[model samples]
Target chain A: MENFEPVIVAFCCHYCAYTAADMAGTQRLTYPSNVKIIRVPCSCKVDALHLVKAFEKGADGVYVAGCLKGDCHFNNGNDRAASRVAYVKKYLEELGIESERLAMFRMSAGMGFQFAQTAKDMTEKIRELGPSPINVAKAQLKGEAA
Target chain B: MITAERKPLEEIIACVAPFRKVLLVGCNECVTVCAAGGRKEVGLLASGLHMALLQQGKSVEIREHTLERQCDPEYVEELNSLIDGADAVLSMACGCGVQTIAGRYKDKPVFPAVNTKFMGASERQGVWAERCQGCGNCLLGQTGGICPIARCAKRLMNGPCGGSTKGSCEIDPDTDCAWQLIWDRLKALGLTENYVEMIPAKDWRTSIGNGPRKIIREDLAE
Candidate 1:
């Protein structure tokens, strides 16, 4: 018997998290293969709709990774994204989902260990939480598509 | 612009709980500007509602559409094709937009997802305050451009009521008396003499005293 695996989506900003992800590869770090990364120009570009849509598409967990506070490549982009992330978390709770499923993480481009650790931790957390509520419908839809 | 705030998620969920399918409509006008309802919001809401129902062991089909402006019949006409299979409509526009859709689709139940707040201006980012009451009259000419009808707590026409103290409204210490604002503007414009002329009693007929109001222009009619 095999253990349950989780699908986690990570929105990484170009200036920081995305670069860290590359650095992690260079350093030969290994993280869960289920962590799908989407590169965005800046963390602020990740809209609330995008977060919700990720879940709707059957992502068991989602995270926004950007530069550390006050360190955004585009001044205050990370700060603005932080506020949006907090607001989305509250909204997710109201939607009757676990707020912990969505989170905003801050790191620098040189922090390859942090990037690998984030992917590992998010995968473990989601594995424990099991599949998202919409996972069943998503699976059915996939079956129909097949 | 008409301002609105989204209703609590529970209330919106309750409205569509009975239906197996719903069409969530968003407006691209005032409600969008206020960050209450827009295209992005429509998608977010559709996802939220879907997940909420999914958690309850229910499978519901939700559709999302945002019109150019929901208050206009031309823009609303776009929904006719999409509304055929939906059980109910959850509108994210102002009260006028909700009524427009309800009036158009008489058979389908149209529910409002936001509370129509007021015809007002945003004081700052994400903050709105009442500015106009739409009393069907233009008294700004005489009151130094400050509207007493909307700003005044009692809607006093002549001067400050006895309740006013220290240039603030009696209702709340934080609120500035509308008449005081009128006086200050009048003083700055050297039009303080306008106060001496006693204004006559207002004609309530122009307001909501009668019923729902309508404006028809024969020349502009198609």
Candidate 2:
């Protein structure tokens, strides 16, 4: 487990988090490479299906990075995304998975440092949790097949 | 519309635990409107079930489908092809929908994913309140369009009872007293006379008190 490198998927809102990620790159801020960012028009555009699908597809950790509260390019998208994240967290708990595997983060377009920090923090958290159970199961199945 | 809520995940997981393949059916009618069973919910449940089962060291195949109306025989026929592949069926609809699927496919074991609550109207976004009991009769005319049989805690024929206080039912402060609402509506429409007129004791034959009832419209019958 100590050598495990977790896979984290970040759904970044195009108007803010995605731009912030670009800014981090330009500023030479170093974040973990484990975090893969999927740009969405708005955080609200990230549906529950997408979040669950992430885990189903072997993502060890998932997060939605949107604009700060009340700062959504489309008003309340971030808030909506937060509630959806909360909903899926309870669902993950029901599935016998750690709810902490999923999260919702808020930041503005100017927060390049925040973006980099969020990625680093999320990566560290998932690394401690180790690989997702779904991924572990898939590995076992593969081993059996081989 | 009919309202329902999903059963606990533990119960559902247990039901499908023995099966390797499951056919998850969702209704696009009442269950969809109540947000209990629909395309989106089917996807969420399917994914959740898949991961949950995998965690148990068992892999299950869950095929998802939503019908226009599960209670209709023609719509349920849509699952004919998929039904053959699944070992069991998980229905995410009201009880009627579950029974419809169970009746259509006798060989496959059918299980309900949700508990049918009641005939209701959406009070607001995400909140629904019971509105009718399907008494097989409509009494909205004399009750000022409010149903005492369904809304009144006692199902009193003439009520407000001693339990009415501050426009709310004594049973629960949050619940509005049906009689109070009836009085207010009657007063507003200048039909207060209807309130004082003695309403005869209701006949229970038309309701569930007797037995299951069915209606056949002769004109529409084939």
Q: Write the per-residue lDDT of candidate 2 for residues B1-222, one digit (tens) a residue.
A: 999998988999999999989999999999999999999999999999998888788888999999999999999999999999999999999999999999999999999999999999999977999999999878999989999999999998788899899999999999999999999999999999998888898787999879889889999877
For candidate 1, write residues B116-161 as lDDT tens digits: 9999999898788899999898899999998989999988899789
Number of the top-ranking candidate, with lDDT as the measure? 2
TM-score of 1: 0.87
lDDT on C-alpha atoms for all candidate structures = 0.90, 0.94
Instruction: Flag regions of model 2 displaced more than 4 Å.
Output: A144-146
- Please tell me what DockQ candidate 2 reaches: 0.84
The TM-scores of all predictions, comma-separated, are 0.87, 0.95
Q: Considering only N, C-alpha and C atoms within 3 Å, which residue pairs clash in candidate 2?
A: none
